[model samples]
Target: MTYDPTNTPAWKRLLTIETMFKEGNERDRLAREAAATAASFPRVIARYLTDAGKALGDKALAVTVTETGPRDDEGRSAFTVGNCTVCPAATTEFWETAIYGGYESDVRLTVTEAAQGAEQVVRRWAEAHATRCRELPVEG
Candidate 1:
């Protein structure tokens, strides 16, 4: 005998189709948002890098800006310059910051709590360390 979907209730079939449509729409919306975010990333990162430079002051040119991206859920973004990576600390206030990587050192700075402008201070420190760091990343 041929397969028969009629064995299933009409309302159940309708519900299944409706669920599929809702899932598809949600996926499409997420894809669109991701695409828009990716497209705008370069400009956004450039602005952050520019801000990092201003924070760097006379040492601005010493560090080479590299990769950058957002951590939206954490309410922060990060960028790597030279051998170091810097990002805002994940806290309730989002006032703290963290920096990782250094010259042949597994250096990390994590602040559980901080006053305002802590991120700026971390950025400045990260930039300075990046300038002097000569350690290259190891390839897998």
Candidate 2:
């Protein structure tokens, strides 16, 4: 299955722009220090998804990302692959590596902990993706 961050909703794109932070002064710090550039956000997401797709293999990729849409929880939408969600937990569902940020932000999510096996892969990919995101220097 093919992956495209552009397929993500508009709301999630906005959230993705701001969700990367440590809050308080760190938000300010990131705004100033992480000034990596913004045009690459979608490219970054697409690259991460591509790499993850390869790592997990074709069958797993086909059954998950390409075949499904983000699921809604309450008023929020969650982007899922297999049984795990990978979206920001507010507004609308969109592709995101925001597995942990939802817990910190006011956004509410359905799942948090990373389990064993496949779930573990999803969890670790999110963590790594989040770290790589630090390179983007997104402006809040």
Who wins the TM-score comparison? 1
> Model 1, which residues run further than 4 Å from truth?
1-8, 44-67, 74-78, 82-140
For model 1, residues 1-140, the per-residue Cα lDDT tens digits are 88777676986899899999999999999889877776664321111222333454533323333333333424334433332323222111132234332222355533322221333444465455654444332438
lDDT of 2 by residue, 1-140 (tens): 79777677986876666665436568787556434432222121221332334554532221122112222223222343332123231111233334334333444333332111223444455445533322221237
| Reference-based lDDT, each prediction | 0.42, 0.35
Q: After superposition, how far is residue 109 of candidate 1 from its true place, in Å?
A: 10
Give the Å error, residue 39, model 1: 1.5
Which segments of candidate 2 are over 4 A away from where they belong? 1-115, 135-140
- RMSD of every candidate to native, in Å, equals 12.0, 23.6
Give me the overall lDDT of model 2: 0.35
Error of 1 at 69 (Å): 1.7
